[model samples]
Target: MPLIDKIAWLHLHDGRILSTRSRGKDAYYLPGGKREPGETDADTLLREIREELTVTLDPASLQLRGVFTAPAHGHAPDVLVQMTLYAATYTGQLQPAAEIEEIVWLSYRHRPQVSAVDQLIFDWLRELGELAE
Candidate 1:
């Protein structure tokens, strides 16, 4: 099985997590992207967040939340996505940038509107009493 390795930021505020929808995409996703060549997890997180949300993540404040794996959305059934989740502090206002079309705060109730991996994340967050219904 092929695996899509990606990093994601878990920015929860008021019991809702920040999520993004890219232009022409139907499902929302967490605000990070794949690791570039020679880039560390922190590097990927910072770069992706800045590109998608226009915020500079505070490197010293990055915290490993968890790693999650699920079927890769919109891909072949045999493909999987491995998401490395992080919680961090950031600077600047969060605005949709680059390919991002919308930014929203999603609670557990919004699970159905997100990607498959994000649904797993919602379950995990809900179980931990971190995500609101």
Candidate 2:
């Protein structure tokens, strides 16, 4: 199966997680992107977050939350995406950049508006009592 290796920064504050929506896209997603060639996970995450959200992540504080494998969103069956999530404290205000059109702080109640993989993450967060309903 072809895998899309992506990273997501989970920023939890006040019972909400930082989420975003691409321009003209309805599904919400965590702010991050695919890994670049010859890039480490930390490097990819920092680059993606900075490019997409204008924030810098602390490399030393990065924490691997989970590795999620699911069917590629809006793609044909048998196609899968492998998402590796990292939660870390970031320093800087978040602003939508690059392909991101809207920045959203999402609680678990808004879970349905997110992608399949994001929903899975939200469920996991809920199970851990990290997300508010």
TM-score between candidate 2 and the true structure: 0.96
For all candidates in order, the CA lDDT equals: 0.95, 0.90
lDDT of 1 by residue, 1-133 (tens): 9999999999999999999999998999998999999999999999999988989999999999999999998999999999999999999999999999999999898999999999999999999999999
Best by TM-score: 1
lDDT of 2 by residue, 22-130 (tens): 9988799888888888999999999999999998999999999999888877778888878899999888989999999999899999988988889899999999999
Q: Against the true structure, candidate 1 has what lDDT? A: 0.95
